[model samples]
Target chain A: MKPFDRLTTSACALPLASIDTDQLIPARFMKRSRADGYGQFLLHDMRFDETGAPRPDFPLNADAAKRAEVLVTRRNFGAGSSREAAVYALVDFGFRCVIAPSFGDIFASNAVNNGLLPAKVSEADAEEILGLIETTGAAVTVDLHDCLIRFGNRNYSFTIDPIWQTKLLNGWDDLDLTLSLSGDIGRFEQRDQAERPWARLPDRPD
Target chain B: MTATRQPQTLFDKVWDAHVVTRREDGAELLFIDRHLVHEGSFHAFNKLKEKRAKVRRPDLTIGVADHYVPTRTRALSEVAPDIAGMIRQLDDNCRANAIRMFGFDDPRQGIVHVIGPEQGLTLPGLTMVCGDSHTSTHGAFGALAFGIGASEVAHVLLTQTLWQKRPKRMRITVDGATAPGITAKDIALSIIARIGADGAQGHAIEYAGSAIRALTMEGRLTLCNLSIESGARCGMIAPDETTFAYVRGRPLAPAGDVLDGAIAAWRELTSDADAAFDRAVLLDGKDIAPTVTWGISPEDALPIGASVPDPAAMDDASRASHVREALDYMGLAPGQALDTIRIDRVFIGSCTNSRIEDLRAAASVLAGRTARVPGLVSPGSHLVKQQAEQEGLDRIFIAAGLDWVGPGCSMCVGMNGDLVPSGERCASTTNRNFKGRQGPGARTHLMSPAMVAAAAIAGHLTDVRPLLRSAS
Candidate 1:
């Protein structure tokens, strides 16, 4: 994962709200191994008809939006199941950042862990940015360090939790963070061994 | 003199109790009290096997083969290879890890969420995690429970702790009494409809007020089960005597003095009277009708008698466009009555609304009536099924021409070959109504079990209030 400073890329606008996880990557596609990329199955039902033909009118299938790196949508994006495949689909399909008014709690957490920034802006700002994209076909610039989005001479700042910003900027693995707290964790284990005996590790009976 | 102020909430107490340590960035290493596993556990188990890391607390973990196991009693040879292999992998992994498992053939086997509470494994004031989102169902026991990703699942397996940031607290108060024909499912749907999918984002909701207090244990579970669908990771209800009595004497519950001591601690888990929430939302219980979803999103629900929303009448541009898209996908007209829509099938099973009480509601509506369309009824657990049979509810369902099958998350996810065909519409008791959620090109209308049973008999959406009135 590269350290995200700033990037300007072509944007694709999906103006819908409450884009759920099941719609991002349906459960039928979740059975396979994660190593197998989920790019082709991104929005499989919405992107294609029942007979496996692409719906040309879908924004992602449109010729102008083919190589988009930034995906913009409305509030509560990724609102349903907690399938990480939803993030896999977006990232694997070359989407680096999702700009929304808000995000599903688990989905936002997963995005940060995978180095995908879930940028939160006001609903009015989101609508304005999306409007610019539709009218001018202009690309947007996302500056992580400055916490701002640039579109056609206007700058819209976004907010992200500081801890998540740190994790995303450094691309730090969560397990590594947990390992860094080993001293405190070990102390807690010792205290808990006496305080809550039933929660002890059953494998090591000692 | 110094003044003291602490806005104590139930979530605050449970969260503060489990912090192993806090980081400067406001993140904390929270200890897990219990872990539930199902077929989705295969991914985490594979990671564990690859790293050769054994489960840290095998006794604290419970495994079951749900999600992909077929509800129909068919030979293994007849099952799809991928589904069968997934179940086999779970069996082998649980055996090698020394984790207790309720396999597909075991009499105790059921949906992970259902069996946990029934077996007294989901106790009060505990932090629980599972790989599936509906794990919030266990929060009905006054616990802080939510879902985790595969990576987090593996982390919990290697070490019984997870790194998490504390979420804001929100209290959803439902005052006044509910009218007749209304159930817990209706209250949940009404709340979601009132508060859009993003209404509770970044908050853990604590359900309170008189209406919530009057609900049974099963009703509380049903309410919490859909918390995830509303964009909140968890929902909880404070434990009382109703909760205590249901948990006592269960197979895994503590005995005698230990039980007495545990109950005393749970009694103190409620929020203080002066506790201020980060945000609060209120609903009148009497205002909520038998609700139903006419669109792809759970938040797209409305009262049973309401007509499909006309996008032209909506003042908000975004909402209007959304309603239009939903109408196109659901094959509905703007002014059409929800109760006039026809359905091709019915399904009554899921982590949400598959308990014994849910079954009884459906049975009461189908006692002497016959199903006008094909439908299936899968119990949440083997215990629920046995109890339903003992009460002769199974006979009523079978007599009504509905398929009474074994326990699993059968048609809810449509992964086990129990799917509605393409272009067909179904009245489902599941939590989600995402496009093609039941199957490719299949349409789903979300409703309560009683409403679903009524639709199954009428071959179209019909208000259950009339049926309830007649039954009484």
Candidate 2:
């Protein structure tokens, strides 16, 4: 993994709570591979009109938010479903960081595993960033190492669970992490075979 | 980082305490206690057989089938042949391994998470493992539980010990009484909306507050089941009298004196009075309304009265892209009121909502009101089905012309034959209204069982509050 090449940033800030995975990639997009560029399909239904014309009342239609990498939302983001496509689509859409008051349990893991940072800041601080963007269209800066999200002279220290923090910082997936402990696992298996061969072995001849 | 008072978060305590060892760029092998198993893991059992391994504590393991079963048509035999095969495999595996099997035919048969608590198998101060992600549902009883992948399932099966990288703790407190007719499902959606979909990522959440504490055991489970959906590894509520009382007399709970000793210890599972959380959020339960997903995602929902969002309101291309796709797949016209949308079918079952109480709630609504649209009300388990029948709740569903069917996970994921045809919208009682969750191209709108019943009768999405009042 590139140590510092990939930095997590957010995408469109909906300023709402309980965004579920179904909204991210929709089960329809799950039909495709991760390489199929789900980014274009991200938030499709929310962005268009019935005839498929883009709706103008939505925030994503604004020029400033179009290319913004860091999405600062209100609170409790990604609150439904265990869909990985939501995270995949977010990452594919060029968002490396998601700043919110909260996140969904499974969606957070999916985001971290996929190299998308689901950053949580206090609601006040999040609103501050949103206010800045709203008033001046200024982007907030999130420093991963400092663990701080900075906006006009204000810095909100976002708390990250140490376990998840470790995962995001190291870019280790479950498979990678499990395989990293091969030595200890091998030792335990060896001892187990010696102590309880029957439990570790097939009853029938192999 | 700016210095601030460190809140003793649930995520911090659980994560820090559980960390056995940590290394840079590696997953930690945190110790697991009281590993739980269910029948969707027949694949894991087969893999264990391939390796000639057996479970460390066959007694510590509990298995049931939830995912592959049909819920709407108790025709466990024919609703879907694939489900039958899975059920057969689960039965065979449990018998061969000597692990306790909560088969569909068993009195204990139910959704794995529901059965775990109702059966007294979920005890506080214990770590539970299940192949189901919503296994976090055990967290409601104050147990540390989360879903594991197929490989981890095999590991837990063989060693009873499963590795975990601890998550930070988050304590989400919803204070005040929930408004009348607002179910825990509404509270959960409101929290997600407030926190954003990925707010609690990398944290184990402890739901604490008068509102949460006031919830029924089943309601707590409903909240916990969606913990992962909110980007948390697991979510839990501290066990209390409600927890103990709910667990008592179950086939799995300790009998009499044994139970007393356990209850004495269970009381200690509550979060310390002064205990702080690394993250905390206080919500007013009153502001929460009946939330419904408008687009493809759960987070894309509005408070039933809201409109199909117009992405042009967004300032960015990326955001616009997501909004557009969600509307496209959902078959919604931007600016249309969500409540006005019509529904074709109603499904009332899943690990999230298919419980005895959920059935009763839906049955109460269906009692004299016939469904305007086709609907299916599936109880979470066979026992629940029987109990509903015994109470004549089944008759209410039948009288309303709803298919009160079998004991399987029917339309929740449409793994079985119970599915909505493409482009058709359904009011589902299960979690996940993602496009195609009910079937390929089928639209699923999630709600409480009662709400699903109301929608079935109205033939559209309608607030269940009025229905609950009218039913009474």
Candidate 3:
């Protein structure tokens, strides 16, 4: 994971709400591991037709959206499925961050893990940003340090969990963070193991 | 007794109990009591291998081959190459990690969510995690269960602790008595319809009131299984006598005094009378009909008798356009009668509605009846199948001209070979109705098992109430 501070790039406005993970990266494409970059399979059902030709009218397939690094969408973006492949698809497709009124809790967590910022602004602010992006094909700037997005002449602030902000900015490994809390975790395990003998983990040879 | 209310919700009680430590960023390191694994967990295993890390608590974790395994009882080699590899990978990874795996041929093999509760692996007052979204289904046992991503899976594998931001608490009270044919799936769908997809976002919902309390364990599972569809991280029902009895004799459950102690502890897991909720909602359970999704969105659902919603009727321009797009993609016309819509296929399985009870509900309808269209009946687990067989549910299904397949997530996710062909319409018991969820250009009408069984026999989206009433 790479540290992300700020980025100014063209924004792709997908106004539809509840763009679920299944639509983001369908289950068919989940067969392969992450090595087989999911860029092509991103929104496969929506992006292309049965003939393998791209849906020309779809936002991502549009001429102007080709270079979009920031995805601005409506509420509840990535609303279904816990497939991290959804995040992989977005990142693999060169998106630095996704701006939405809200995001699926799991999808937002996966986004931060992959160094992809899921900036959440108000619904009205999101619509305004989408409108600005539509009126002017200008780039949208997202500053993680300030939690603010600038598009056209307007600037909109977003809220993210402070911890997620640190992770996105510093590219912190969640595993490492857990490892750092090993002392407390160990103690909890010791007490838990003693208290709930039935809940004790079964023995396994290392 | 004039006392200040020190109210705490069920989520707070369970979450606070499991907190290992709080991080600087306000995220807490919560201990995971039980971790369920499936074929989708292979990527996390690979990452663990890459990092050369040992699973910290292999005993707490259990793996099963479900997502990619065929529900047709076919040999592994005969399955799709990619899918076979995933199943094989799950077995190999579990073996390497010294974790117990319920493979395809194992009698205990089933959907991760199904097997967990049936085997008593999903206990009350436990903080459970799985790599699949439907892990929320285990919350029916009063466990603080939620799904985690592959990377989080690796983290949990390496350390039995997960860092999570505390979610807001919500209570969804379904009031009134449910109608005869109104299954848990209908109540869940009706709730999502009332509240848009994001209605529960960032909240851990506690389902309560008379209607929810009346549901069977299987029905509770069915309701919680669709929590993710409503954008809730997890949905839970506090453990009661019903929940206690269900967990009492399961194979993995505690016995005797240990069980007594567990029950006593679980009894305290309910929300306090004066508990403050971030959000509280109410819905009439009796009002829920044999609902079905007519559009790409699960929230775009209506009663079986209602016509497809016209985009022109939508007040919001953006929302109206979305309706138009879903109608176009679904090849459905506005104002079209939902029951008149023909379905090419019917699927009656998935974590949402594949339990023994679900099968029995469908079987009761399909008995002495024949399916007008191709229909597949995949049980949730081997136990469910065995129980169904013992009760002649399989005979009923076969007699009704439906295929009684093996246990696994079959057409629900379509990672396996089962899928509705392109440009085909299907009445599915699955939770998701997203575009192409069952297959490319496939239109899925999410419904309850009874409704699916009714549609399968009718060859269209029929109102199941009349059929159910007639059968009784």
Top model number, DockQ:
3
lDDT of 2 by residue, A1-206 (tens): 32322343333567654455555655434434345677876766666655778888877666666687887775556655555557667767777888887776566655766667778887677767777777766556777776887665767888766666766677654544454565665565556445322122112111
Question: What ranking emerges by DockQ with the best candidate at the front?
Answer: 3, 1, 2
Candidate 3 i-RMS: 1.7
Which regions of candidate 2 deviate over 4 angstroms? Answer: A1-206, B1-28, B72-81
Could you say which candidate leads in TM-score? Answer: 3
Top candidate by lDDT: 3
| TM-score of candidate 1 versus the correct structure, residues matched by position | 0.96
TM of each candidate vs. truth:
0.96, 0.72, 0.97
lDDT ranking, high to low: 3, 1, 2
Candidate 3, residue B168: Cα displacement in angstroms equals 0.5
Model 1 chain A: ten consecutive residues of lowest lDDT: A197-206
**Tens-digit per-residue lDDT, B225-286, candidate 3:** 98888889899999999999998788788888888888888898999998999999999877
For A40-94, candidate 3 gives per-residue lDDT tens digits of 8888878888888998888999877778899999888988899999999999998
Off by over 4 Å in 1: A63-66, A196-206, B1-7
- lDDT at position B334, candidate 1: 99
Shift of residue B62 alpha carbon in model 1, Å: 2.0
- Superior candidate under TM-score, 2 versus 3: 3
Pairs with backbone N, CA or C atoms under 3 Å apart (clashes), candidate 1 = none
